[model samples]
Target: MTEHATAVAALTPAIADGPQTIKVIISGGFAAVYRDMLPEFERSTGISVETGSGASEGAGPKTIRHQLANGTKADVVILSREGLHKLNEDGRIRAGSEAGLATAPLAAAVRTGSRKPDIGNDVALRKALIDAGQVVAPSSTSGQYVRDKVFPRLNLPDTVRLTLEARGTEAAEALRAGKANLSIGPTSELVQESGIEVVGLLPPDLQLVQTFTAAIVSDAQAPEAAKRLIDFLSLDSDILLAAIKRAGMERPRG
Candidate 1:
C-alpha cells in the first residue's frame, strides 16, 4: 500500500465502533476550514462531528473560555496558541497534546465597492489610517496587536477614529452597516464576509500572525477519535494544505 494510505489505515483501529460522535469547541479563526473539512472526515472515518464556535476574545459568555467554564462538553478544542496554553495550564486539555494547526495574518478591508486604500508600506498605512473617517477592529488578538504594537510604532493614534467590536465578523459588520470605513482582523474572518472586500495582508513589518492550535480535552469521552481528527487536520497531507489555503490561512511554519 502507498505510504499515505498505510498511515491512514493504521488509524482505523482508533476509530470508535458504531458511528461515534465527537464534540468540538472552536474559535472563529479556524472555524471556517474545520466546518468545510468535517464532511470529508465523516465520510472517511464514519464519525459524526458536532461543533460550537465563539469569538477568540471578549468578556462575553460566548467565548470559548466561558463556554468551557460553564461545563460545556468538548472532545476537542481549537483556539489561539496563547489561549490553548492558558487552558492547558488550567488543566482543561491534555498536557503535550496540543498541536499547531495554521497561522492567519491580519488583513484590512473596506465596504464593497469602496475605494481600496493604499497600505503597502508603513508610511502609506499610517496615512491611510490617519485619513480614514472611522476604523473598526475586533476586540481580540489582532485588535490588541494593532492597538498596542502597531499604533505605538506609528505614533499616530489620534489620527484615526477606532471602534472595537466583540467578534472578528463584527468588524465587517460595522463596515456593512456604514458605521466604519475600514475594518481590520484576521484574513480568514475578513474574506468570509460578503459585504467587505479584503484589501490584503498588513505589511510584513507591522503584521501579526496568530497561530492556532488544537488539543484533545482532558476529560474527553472520545480522546482517540479526537486525536485522529486532529491528525486529519494537520498539514501532513496536501489535501489539508489546500483546504487551509482555501480557508484563507497558511500552514504553520517553523
Candidate 2:
C-alpha cells in the first residue's frame, strides 16, 4: 500500500466513532483532485464525502460565497485563499483552520487536432491572441487576472475577441464546440476536458498561480470528521503529491 494509505489506515482506528458523513463545498480549482482522493479517504476513514461545486471567483449566486451566505450545510470548504479569507471574516469558516493545498497555474488550450499556437513568450502570446478568431476564458480567478492584468499589460485590451464563460469547464467546452479558437483557465480545469489539447502553461512572465486552501466550516455538523478530512489531505505523502500533479497542480512550498 502507499505510504499515505498506510498512514490513514493507522489513524483510522482512532476515529472509529467520528461522524460518518462529511459535506464539502469546493471550488472548481481543486475539484478534480479532491474527487480523485475521495474514495481513498472513504476507504481509510469509513466516512462518506458529499461534494458540491462553486466557482472560485465572481459574485454569482452559485459561487461558494453565495452558498455560504444562503447557509449551505458544509462541513468543509475548499476554495481560493481569497475566498477562504472572506469566509473566515464572515464567520463561515473556523478561524485558524485553514490549510494550503495546491497551486495551479494558468494554461492555454485548443480544440483537439488544432495547430498548437505559440505562447512561449509575451510577444508570441500577444500575437497568438491577435491571430485567433475567438478566445474563451472563465469569468473566474484566472480569467479575471487575464482581463484585469494581462490584457492591459499586453496592450491589446480591445484587440482580441474574448468570450467569457461563467466557469472554467464552460470555457473548455466552448473550445471543444468550435465556439472559440483558444481557451485559458487553470491548468486543472483545462486538463479535465477530453476534447481539448492543453497547449501548455502560460509563459512564466504572464502566468498567474492561484493557491487553493481548505478549512472547516464554523457551524459544521461534523467538525471532527471535517478536521480529519483536512488532516488526511494535508499529509505530505507521495500519493497525495502524485494526485495533485496529475490534477495539474503543484504542492505548495513551506
Candidate 3:
C-alpha cells in the first residue's frame, strides 16, 4: 500500500460502527500542528480522522462545497474564521457547531541565511521593503492587510512590489528560492515550511489577526467524533493553538 493508504489502513481498526470515523478536511495551515496529535486522539476514543492540507481561506470551504455538491463525504472542516462563517451561512456547515480555534497574526519571514530586514518601525519598515528586490505574500487575508494597511501606513506602497501567492506556503517557497527577499503570511503558515526564519511579527500597530475556526458539518458521518474533534480544538492541550503560536501566532483571549 502507498503511504496514504497505509495511514488510512492504520486508522481503519479504530473506526467504530456507531461513532464511525470522522472524515475531516482541514486546511494545510493547521495540518502540521494537528498531525502529531491525531494518534493520541484516535487511541483514546477509537475515532479515526482523515485530514487534507493545502489551500487557504475560502479554498477549504470551496472544496467542501464541491464535495457536498457531488455527495462526497466530509464530517468536519477547519479553516479561516471567515470561511467557516461563510460555509455556515450557506448551510454547508452547521450554524451552531462553529467554533473558534485560534488566531494567527500576519508576519514577515526571511529565507534562512538571508539578510534580515528591519520591520520594527514605520520608517525602518519602509526602508526594508525598498531595499528588498521582491516580496511574496498571499492575495487574501495577510496580503490584504499588508497592501491595504501596512504599506500605506509605512508610506512604502511604491517601495516593494507585492507578489500575491495563491496559497500561504507558496510565499515561503518564493523566499526559499530567493525569488523574493521576503515572505509574509499567517504566522502559522510561515512557520511550517522549512528554510525560513520568521523575521518577527509586523509590529502590533501593523498586525492583523486572522482567526482560524473549526466546525462540525451538518451532514457529518460521525457526529460524535466530529464533536470530539471540536472539543479537542478548544482545549489548551490540543496543540492547535500552540502550533499556531509556534508558527508565529499571538495568544488569543477567551
lDDT for model 2, please.
0.84
The estimated TM-scores of all candidates read 0.91, 0.93, 0.81
> Which 10-residue window of candidate 3 scores lowest in summed lDDT?
1-10
Clashes found in each candidate (C-alpha, N, C closer than 3 A): 0, 0, 0
Instruction: Tell me the tens digit of each residue's lDDT in model 3 across 47-74.
Output: 7777754343423433444455567678
Highest TM-score: give the candidate number.
2
Instruction: Score candidate 3 by lDDT.
Output: 0.69
**Native-structure RMSD, model 2:** 1.8
* Candidate 1 positional error at 51, Å: 0.7
TM-score of 3: 0.81
True-structure Cα RMSD, model 1: 2.3
Pairs in steric clash, model 1: none
The order by descending TM-score is 2, 1, 3
Candidates 1 and 3 compared: the better one by TM-score is 1
C-alpha lDDT of all candidate models, in order? 0.81, 0.84, 0.69
The lDDT, on a scale of 0 to 1, for candidate 1 is: 0.81
Q: lDDT of model 2 at residue 59?
A: 71
Q: How close is candidate 1 to the true structure, as a TM-score?
A: 0.91
Residue 199 Cα positional deviation in candidate 1, in Å, after optimal superposition: 1.1
